[model samples]
Each structure stands twice: as structure tokens, then as C-alpha cells.
Target: MISAPLTRRAIFAQAWPIMLGQTTVPLVGLVDTAVIGRTGDATALAGVALGTVVINMIFWTFGFLRMGMTGMTAQAEGAGDAREVEAMLLRGVVAGVGLGVVLFALQIVLIPLALETMAGGGALDDAARGYVSARFLGAPASLAIFAINGWLFGRGRTRAALALQIVMNLVNIALNLLFVWHFHMGARGVGLGTACAEWISLAVGLAIAGRGVDWGRILSPALFGGGALRRLFAVNADIMIRTIALLSLFLWFTNAGARLGATALAANYVLMQFVSVSAFVLDGFAFTAESRVGQAIGAGSRSAMVRAIRLTGEFSLLAGIGFALLFFVLGPALIAFFASNPAVRAQAGAMLPFAAIIPAIGVPAWLLDGIFIGATRGRALRNAAILATALYIATDLLFRPFGESGIWWAFMASYLYRAVSLGAYLPGLLRTIEVAEPANGP
Candidate 1:
């Protein structure tokens, strides 16, 4: 195995590429919004937003493939157990595939329900429903891709993971242009583009795994036996609850804005893209922390954990500052890109300063989440998130008399609370340490 210092650097190196790969997906969405804006149809924009919300809700549910797998595999790696590492990957894939099938079956029921519930009555509603229905058809592929990504990241193959994501985005973008513009397929075209890209990505991911994955023992039923499946489900349940809370906040935000009116919602939506971009970038550092810190904790190396935490925290802070500055400088141009309507652009522009400040304020919470998760303190992580979210809801209720600005302030406060709560737990965590054996036939 590589030395501690080198392994840490390797983690970051892998993360940077993965970060770029991850960022490209959002960039593609931004481009899609931009292109659709030129068509001068607010319904089209609303369609994309609505469809995205539904898909994201579903996708986030399976985020366990990434979070659960990373923690389990990193620990295995740290324990110096190649067989266990292989088992984790195989179990994750099987579980993800099973979940994907379930999701596909549920989509039939879900699409109509979502349209009625989330999409307001109008042409926009019709467009959103159409888009969602088409996209739902690719549930299996999308979930499969999510599983593949989680396994890859867990194995510390960040570059390969990044490459797969980039390819997916590139394919999606090309298809978006071809179907939406060339064929005049409109919202349905965009959905089709996403579906096609997902399948392609799943195929590529499987091929890549075949090349590098140790296959001799992977096919054994022991890998997916009762004990393994139970552990997988248990971890997944924890993550799913956490993700549901997280996604519910955004959904609530969207729904709340919708109640205020489309213009407000649209403006908020535009601003949210900025938040998404910033969070994804910050997540690169977080993912690095998850892998490195989990490995450190598993290896029973207190020193490695301390160092990993320090490096990740410092780097996240630096990265957050850069994102803050980027938002400050490019605020206008970015807002204008998503919003062509004068009112939407103006309102979003006014909100730019608040949005720009979020990364810096939220970085601590984000980084802490990674640290805690790596340490396998998921219960703490869940509690911290729940507490912060409750704080946010309470603050929002009290501040509702103000305006949108008040809501943004509440959002900022939530991040602050999360950071503080998680930070408070760190001292106790550092006092306890457990290291795994080395990987060479441990």
C-alpha cells in the first residue's frame, strides 16, 4: 500500500478530476436552460424545473449507493481486506439494480401523482408531466449509473468515475441539442436525451468495472447472501432518511416559492442553480474526505484521521472562498444566462449577494458532514441535519412576515446551525479511535 501522505495526495488528485466531471452535469443543465430560454417559452423553463425536481427526489433516494458504499468500502480498504472491498462493490451493484427495478415500477404511479401535486395547472403543467413521464422510463439505467459511480468512488478510482460522468454529460448535451433543436421535440426531447445518456453511462461503467474489478469471487452468492443484504439495507435506510430530509427542504423551498407566484419561483430557481454549482464543487473536497478519512479510521490510525480532517477542512475553506468570489464577480452574467425575463433577471440579480455568501457559510457544515460520515458516525450526522433543518423551518416561520430576503436569511442560519452542531461532536469523536489491519491478506 502507498504511504499515508501519498495516499492522501492521491485522494485529492482523483477528486479534482471527479469534481470537473461532476460540475459538467450541472453546466449541461445550465446550457439546456439557456438554449430553451432563447425559445421564449416560460413553460419550457418551468417544465425543466418541474421535471428536475421530481427526478432529483427519486435520485436522492438512492444516494445510498454513493454514501453507504463509500463508507463501507473505504473501511474495507483501510482494513486491508481486498475480498471485503470486492464484496461491498458487488453487493452495492446488486442492491442498486434491484432498487432501480422497483423505482421503474413505481414511476408509473409517481409521474401522475407528481404532476397533480407539484405542477400547477396550465401549459407548464402539461410540459412538466410529459418530461417526467419520458424520463421515468430510464429509471433503471439512472439507478444503475448511480450504483456504478458509488462503487467507483468507494474504490478510490476517482479519475475513472470522473471520466464516466463527463462522458454521460457530453452524451446528454449532444442529444439535447439534436433532439430538442434539430427535431423540435421540445421538453420530451430533453427527457429522451437524459434517458439515452444514462443507458450509455451504465454500459460504460459496467465495462470499466469488468476491466478493473476482481471478478473471480464477485459472482459468489455469499457476497449477496442474507447477512450482506441486511447490512446494505440498514445502511441504505439511514442514508435514505437523511437524503429525504435534505431533499424535502429544497422541495419545500420550491413549493413555497411556487405559492408566491411563478416569477418568484423562477427567480429562486435561477439562483438555486448557482447554489447547486457551488455545492457540487465543494462536494469534491467532501468526497475526498469521505474516502481518506474512512480509510484512516478503519486502519485504526488516529493520526491519519486528524491529518485528513485538517487537510480537508482547510481545503474546503479555501475552495469555498474561491466560489464566493466567483459568484460575486460573475453574478450578473450567470443570472442572465438562466433568466431572460427582465423581472426574473432583476430579482435573481438582487439575490446574488446572498447566494454568493452561502458557500462560505455552509462549507463548514458540508465538510463536517463528510468527516462525520467517514468516521461512521451517521447517527450524529443525521441528528445534526435534522436539528439544522428544524431550526430552518422555525426561523422561516418566524421570518415569513418579512420577504424573500428573510427566507434567504433563514437558509443561511440553517447552514450555520448545522456546522455548529456537527463541530460540537468532533472533540468526542477524536478521542476514540479504531484502526483496521493492513490490506495484504489481513
Candidate 2:
């Protein structure tokens, strides 16, 4: 799509930027925590944390805006459908902003219900409510930015995407410091900062993406064409359900750990950070696979699709192994850093081996997700995710008697199930590649 051949160099070129952008995402939260914690206001700190959790849960549900946009836009680009490419961006933006508006409208009801369920009635709930109110104001911008970034990734504009992420993170950090440290507005200040940064990023994203584009056709009747709208919604709906299923699995995992004891919960939380870090890094390759495979399919080249899978898989495997080794060698120190409490640190250390091996064990599942996402095989993804999650819950319940280690075992089993279930659909996905080889081709 970028007029460059797909090679390892090209793949890394696309991937590294995405990885860097993803890694920056956590920094925004870290800055919020640091600025709020320094005030010695434990209530404010906890409120911000709770608020963040709620916002992430809500926003993540709409992540289909990004994933769906990426697949559709990449296919359009691969097919050399320049008009459709532009239309896809407009459709994604409209959908994103529209969904954000719906979320904003529902905040009055959603906020109280979510906070009450998570924190119950207390000063904590009030504080979290304040934070959520401020942060939720930028819902329109935040969700719209997801579509913008997805469009950029679909077009293989990784550098542009990375640039936007860096800009947003920097803006967020700066505003957070000013609001929390200087203004001393507490948790609300943190939320306000993030919201302001999001609006700024939205403007910046539009400016970047709108350059050299024909807005006339993009805003035309074809943008709302019935068939296209149906396909877009169908894909988005499937991805959303698939995402929710995975979220449910992790929620269960966390809830199960909580039942074990406070120390176990803290240890599990710390251990999850290790998994998250590796996931963000390895996601680079997964994302690359999505774009490449989508392109190959769009062009109706099964050979190209095979090559994409092979190359992305190889890179993902290597990166996963590297992460596992790093986690194994530095397990104790990392645990100590995340968890200062002696009991939590020790509990996490005992289970560190499980976390260490997870990157390697999780590689296949992660890669398969990318492959399917790229192929835009939403039904296959949805089915696999649901089935795997059910199996995971059963395994978790069956191993409940083994204590914390059993939870880890169930977690590992979840990854295996995901990989296997997705692999089951991969053959059918390949069959959908409508190949048309040239008669004189060697």
C-alpha cells in the first residue's frame, strides 16, 4: 500500500512505532498516579484509580472503532479503492463521535451505577464521581481519536500514529502536572487534564488525517451507502462481542485472585503488569500482521497472505521468547519494584515463574488474534473468544482447590484454549482468500 515490498525490515518499520506508541499509553496513568499521590491525599489517589478503571472499562468497550476501521481501511487500500479509503475514514469518525455522544448522554446513569457496584456508597464514591464527571466530558474526542489512529494504522502510516500518541501523552502529562501540582484540584484536576489533552489530540488527529483529502466525496451519499453501513456495523459488533468475552475472562481471573486473600490479589495485580508490558511490546507484530494480511486478502493473493502470517509469526515468537527470558531473569527485582509490601512481594515471587513463561505461552493466541483481526473474520473471532472464555471459566473452577497456583494454571489454560480455538477457524479464513494466480506466473 505504501509502494514498498513487505519484508522483515518493512514489518519492523511498521511495528516498532506501534509498540512505542502503546508503551506511551501507560505513562499517562503513571503521571496521574504520581501527581495525585504526592499530595498525600489517599482518598484522591484511590478515587483517581477507581475513576480510571471505570473509564477504561467504558472506553474499551468501544475499541471496535479502532479495530474495525483498521481492517476495512486496509482492505480498501489494498484493493486500490482510493474513494472507499476516504469514505472509510469518514464512516469511522462519524461512528466514533456518535458512540461517544451516546456514552456522554448515559454518563449520569452509568457513572453512579458503575461506581456503586465497584466501590459502594462512601467518600470514595463521591471522589470517584467527581473525577469521572470531568474525564467523561472528553468522551467525544477520545473515542474519535481511536478511529483516527485506526485509519492511520490501516494506511501504514505508523509514524503519524506514533506522533499523535506522543503528542497526546505529552499534553496529558503537562496538563496533569499543572492541574494537580499547581492548581491542587485533586482527582478532578487529573480528570480535567486528561480530558483537555484528548480534545487537543482529536483536533490534531483530524488535521493530520485530513491533509490532501477530497472532503467533498467523503461527505457524499456514498458515505452512508446501505451495504457499506451494514458491513461496517456487522464487523464492529462482532469485534465488540469478542473483546467483551476476553474482558470477562480477565475480570473473572482478577475476581478469583481476590477471593484467595488481599496479599494474593496484590501479587496477582503486580504479576499482571509483567504480562501487560510484554503484550504491549509484542502487539507491534500482531498489528503488523493485521495490516499485511488484510492487504493480501484485499488483493486476493493467498501467497501474500501466507507470507504475511509466516513473517509476523516468526517475529512475534522471537519477541515473546525474549520477553519470557527477561521476565524470568529479573522476576524478583521487578516484583519488588511493583510491590513494596514484603508479603505481596514474596507472594508474587513464588508465582513469578508462571508470569515468566506466559509471554511464550501466549504468543500463539496473540498472533492468531492479529491474523483474524487482519482478515476481518469477525464471526470466527467472536465464536473462538466465547468458546475459549467458557472453557477458561470451567478450568478455573475445576482448579479452584489448588489455591493461587491453580489460578495461574487456569490462566495458562486460557491462553492455550484461545490459540487452539482460533487455529480451528484459520483454515476457513485461508479458504476465503479468493486467489487468482496469473496464467504465466512461475
Candidate 3:
């Protein structure tokens, strides 16, 4: 095992790049929002908003492709298995290409569904259609890029991953200006620009990740064995189910918030901004745990894994505390910024305590998620999510007397359940590692 100091440095080295990458992710969306909003034609802005939402939903669902590949690639790297690494990348590309083809084929149905979801008025329908059509052309590139980035991240090349994203965003921004402003192509232009850049980014990612890969070896029938294919499909399927469950909770929260009076709903919306910000920042540390733990598992180094888990816990605790402090001190101001009416502002401020506690509460679950993902314990993760989700629905129903405060309480319980459930599962995981080590029977 490496010394604590070295492990800490390694964790930071891995974590910081991911933080920067996560930071840039929202910037592209903000730029899209800004550029599209400035067009003066409200219909065009509305169209882009609806169109992007649809795009986001579609892409986010397949995020398992990236996450599922990360653990595999990291393990391959730790095992020093070059052929496995190549196959990991190639497998993702194949999955992504296949999925993208399906997405392209379904656009005829998806585009209209997107419009209906946004409650498309006739005025904005055409504009939304234009944007959706243009973006569909790039679905393949986008999904494929997810796989490539995941491989880069798993291989501990987060800086390279960051560079690819930064370049993609820069290209996206530059083209947004050129096509939307200069050419006045409107919604279609924004979609086209993103598509073009993703295609470019894929080329860049492939060039970076694909270097020295033995495509000849990868093309061999031996490498594309049945076992690898099954593992890949199984891991991804588990993650996809978990993702769906997780997303469903958020949607339920939102839908329930809407059912509450408009003022309370608005307050909850702003309050959620705190959760979103904390999540992005905290994900950096989670990512570090993922890479280090995967490497440790692959190398059969329990000491290294212990060091990683400890360091990650320390970092997560500090971040959770820091988030708690911010939400306590600044929550009112942040809430006030989004809450227009005095009633909404006051109610939101009242809920600051709920919001304030979530970061600290959520630390364990978030940190553990990284460990689970790294270890590829998808069944455990999936089980935890299922239970947590059920607890959330039950809590919400049980606490209806408290109104909006009740909803927030339900969310808190759900987070706590996730942490507790996962923490309970950790011992079994650790025992497995212990049993596997020093016996020399394998």
C-alpha cells in the first residue's frame, strides 16, 4: 500500500480534474440557454428549451454506458491488461453506435413526444421540431463520446477527458455564435453546432484514448468472447435500472412540489439549487474513490482500497460540512434570488434547515456510490436504490400532514436510508475482499 500522504495526493490529482470537468458541464448548457434566450423570438427560445430537455432526458438515460465502462477499464488498467483495455473501449463504441442507431430510428416518435411533453403550442412547435431534427444527427457521436470519456476517466486520464470536453464546449460556443448569430440559423443552428462539435470531440477522444491500442488484437474473436459480452451487458443493465429508480425519485419530488401551492413549489425549486450545486462539487471526490478503488480491486490490494476509502471519507466529510455551512448562511439569499413573492421567500427561508442538513446527510450515500460503482457491485447498488425509493414514496405518503415540509422530510429520510442500507452492505463486501486475500487458493 502507498503511504497516506501519497494516497492523498493521488486522490487530489484525480479529484481536481473531475471537479473542473464537472464545472464545465453546466457551462455548455448555460451558454445554450443564454444564446438561445437572447434571440428575442420567444418561440425560438421556448423551442430550444423544450428541445434540449428532450435531448437531456434521452442522453441521461444511457449514462450507464459511460459509468459501467469506467470500472471495467480501471480494473483492466490495474491488472495491466492492455487487450482488455482495448476491448473495453471498443465494446463501449459498439454499444454506443448500436444505441445511437436506435435513437436515430426512433426520432420520428421521440420528437413529437418531446413536443407534447413541453406542451408545445403551435407557434413554437415548428421551431422545436427544427432543433430536435438537427440534434438527432449527432446522437451517435454523443453516446460514443460518453464511452470514450469514461475510459479516459477510468484510466486516470481525467485531464485528457477534461481537455476533450473543454475543446468540445469551445467548439460548441464558437459555432453557436457563428451559426446562430452570424448565419441566423436559429434553433437548428444551435443543434447543428453541438452535433458538429460532438463529432469533432469523438475524433479527438478516439485519437487520445485509442493510441497504441492493438486493433488487430481487438478484432480477434478471442477478445470478443461471450463472457466479456455478458459481463458488460449485465453491469450496464444493473446500472440502467438503478439510474431509472434514482431519476424517478427526483421526478416524483418535482411533481409533488408542483402539487403544493405555487409559492411553496417555487421555494422548493430554488431550494433544490443548493442540492444540485453540492452534488456537482461532491461528485469530484466520489470520482476519485471510483478510480482508486477500481485500481485497488484489480490489483488485489486491500490496503490500497482501505486507504482510498479513508481518504475519500475525510474529503467527503469536509465537503459536507462546508456545504452545510453555506446552505445555513447563504440559503436565504439564494432562495430569495429565485423566489419572487414575499411569501415564497419566507417559506423557502424556513426550509433552509432541511436544505442545510442534506449535504451532511447525503455524504455517505454519495461517497458509497463511488465505491459501489468502482467495485461494480451493481446488484447491491440496485437493491439499495430500490429500497430507498420505496422508503421515499412511503415517507411522503405518511408525512402528508406536514405539507411541503413533509416532502422535504421524505427526501431526507430517503437519503438517510440510502446511506444506511449501503453502509450495511459494506461489511459483506469487505469480508469478500478479506476472504479472497492471503488464502492463495484461487
Candidate 4:
């Protein structure tokens, strides 16, 4: 078995690299916007923005590949199943690339449908369509990279994962500048540049992931047998459902903000940046929990598993409190940084208290998600998401009379529901290690 010390220092070692990697993610979007905006072409900028939303929405549907790959591979690593570890990556890559191809093939139908819902017709539509068309070409690479990154994370190769992210972002940024500034390809260039960067990153990722891998084990028929594929797909499907349900809650939140008025919508948008920032930072601890907990489960060490959860949870808790304090102290300045409109700034400031405490309130839910994901408890996750979402919507409606503040309260309520609902499954999760095999293994 893979015996690694489970300690707070180990948790920090795992988390910092992930946090650094996540920090670069938002930079890519900023670069995309900056390169496009320099031309002073509002239509092109808006098109690129809308196209990004559409592409992200589509790609997110298959995010299960990344999460599932990490869980399965981590478990295999914990079990000291060298063969299974390699096989997990192989299966993940195949499924990722295969699903990406399907998405590309259906781009004609998918792009326009997504655009119609998200954008108006004419030049804007055409610009968005152009951007999406070019970006869609890299769908396979993008998805494949997801699997590769997942594998790296599972192996606790956080430095490699960090390098992979930095390479992709830097390459994308450089190419975007070259395409927009030098070639004048507008939104199409932006999309193409990102697509090309993804492909290049995939090449690098493969070289890294393939190092010392046992091809014989990965290519074995037993590894790709019907039973294995079924198990992988089952976990993936459940995670997908869970992801979609969670996304719907946010989408509804955004829609609700819109109904409140343009000011509220804009304010909420700015406020969401706070939530996003916190999530990005907190994900480091959550991801650490994933690998550590997965290894603990795989080794069937209940104490290790409990230690993993407690340690990671503690770090996340402290980080969340830190964020809350920072937001409360610098709330206005940060609000000003994100918003220029006095009205928007004022509204966002009014709502800042709600956003400020979210990281703290939401920590348990986020940490629990990582714990369950590591355990491969997909059914528990799926059920909790559905129930939590339903309660969120019900609470939102119930709080309708309070307006925007009520919505924020309901949003907070969703996090609580998710934690409580999933928390209910902890006993069963712990009991699994007492058995011969994990109850929820893929």
C-alpha cells in the first residue's frame, strides 16, 4: 500500500500548488477579454464573451471525467494497484476524447441552440458562432487534458499539474495576443489561439502522464472489460447529474438576480466574483481532501480517512474564515475594484455582507463534496444535490418578499442543505472501510 503521513503539513503541501494553479485560470479569461477589447470593437468583445459562456457550459457537462478519473486513480494508487492506476488514466483519456469528439460532431446543433438562448441575432450571433466554431476544434484536446490533469492530481503530482496549467494559460495568452494584435483575426483568432494552446498542452500532458507507465497493463483486455467500463460510466453519470443540478441552482440564482432589476443583476454579478475567488482558493483544500481521503478509503484505513477529513476540513475552515475577514475589512475597496457604477457599487456593497460570509457558511458543504467525491459515493452526492437544489428553490420562493436579501439567504440555505444532506451519509461512508471492499468503489 502507498503509505504517506497524513498530517496538516501534508495537507498544506498539497493545497498550495493547487491554489497557485487555480490562480492562473481566471487570468486566461482576462487575457481573452483584454486581447479582444483592445480593438475597440464592442460587438467582437461581446461575441467572445458570449461564446466563452456557451463553450464553458458545454464543456462543463462532461466535467465528470475529471472528477471520476481523480477518484478512481487515487483509489488505485492507495490500493497499490499499479496496473489499475495506469488503466484508470487510459479509460479516462479514451472516454474524455470520445465524448469530446461527439460534442464536436454535434457542434452545429449545440452551438446555435446555446447561442439562441444566450444571445440576440445578427452580427453578435455571427461573431459568437465564429468564435465557437474555432474553439470547438479543440474540444478533444480540452477534454483529454482534463483526464490527464485528473490523473496527475490523483497521483499527488500537484507540481506537474501546476506546470500543466501554467503552460496552457501562458501559451493561450501569448497566442491570443499574437492572433488579435498581429493577425487581426478578431474573435475567431481568440478562439483559435485557445484551441491551439489546448492541443499543445495535451501533447505536453501526455508526455508527462506516460512517463514510466506500464502500457501492457493499460492495454490489457481485462482492464477494458465490460464490468470496468460499466462501473466507470455509472460513477460518471451520477456525478454528471449532480454537477448539472448544482449548476442549475446557480443559473437560477442569476436569473433571480436579473428579475430583481438591472442594478441587482449587475451587483450580484460583481458579488459573484467574491464567491468565485473564495471557491478558487478553497478548492485547494478540497482537492487535497479528495486524494488523501481516496487513498485512505482505498487502504481501508478508517482512522486515516477520518484524519484526512479532519485535517483538510480544518484548513478549509481557517481559509474560509480568513476570506470572510478579508472581505469584511476590504469589502468596499474590492467592490469598487469590480464595479464602476455608483449604483451598482452601492447595491453590491449592501449585499457584500452576504457574499462575505458565504465562504465560511459554505465551507462544510464544499469540504463534504470533496470527501464524498473521494469516497466515490456518487449516489449520495447525486441525491444530496437534487434535494438541496429543491430546498434552495423552495426557500428562494418563500423568501421572495424580502427581495434580493432573501435570495442571498436562500442561497446560504442551499449550502446548509447540501452539508446536512450529505452529512447524513457519513456513517455509511465510514462503515465501508470496515468491510472487505469499499461500498462505493469504481
Q: How accurate is candidate 3 locally (lDDT)?
A: 0.77
TM-score of candidate 2 on Cα atoms, chains taken together: 0.89
The predicted structure with the larger lDDT, 2 or 3, is 2
Per-residue C-alpha lDDT of model 4 across residues 370-432, encoded as one tens digit per residue: 888888888998999999999999999999999999989999899999999999999988887
Q: How many backbone clashes does candidate 1 have?
A: 8
TM-score, predicted candidate 3 vs. hidden true structure:
0.80
Top of the candidates by TM-score = 1
TM-score of each: 0.93, 0.89, 0.80, 0.86
Which 10 successive residues of model 2 have the least lDDT summed?
Answer: 115-124
Residues 1-442 of candidate 1 have per-residue lDDT tens digits of 2124634476578569767886997787777777666676767777777777877877777887878788777878877888888777667767777787888788878777766667366877777777777787777778767767776766677888888988899999999899888998888888889888888888888887657667896778787776888987786676677777777666666666666666666777777788878888888888888877778777787767777788777778988999999999998998877778887788788878888999888899888877876666767777777777777788888988877887788877878988997798998888887543455522
Taken over the whole model, the C-alpha lDDT of each candidate is 0.77, 0.82, 0.77, 0.82
Clashing residue pairs in candidate 2 (N, C-alpha, C atoms within 3 angstroms)? none
The clash count of every prediction, one per candidate, is 8, 0, 0, 0
Expressed as tens digits, the lDDT of each residue in 362-402 for candidate 2 is 99999999888888888888999999999999999999999
lDDT of 4 at 151: 84
Clashes of 3: 0
* Deviation (Å) of 301 in candidate 2: 0.4
Kindly indicate the candidate among 1 and 4 with the higher TM-score: 1
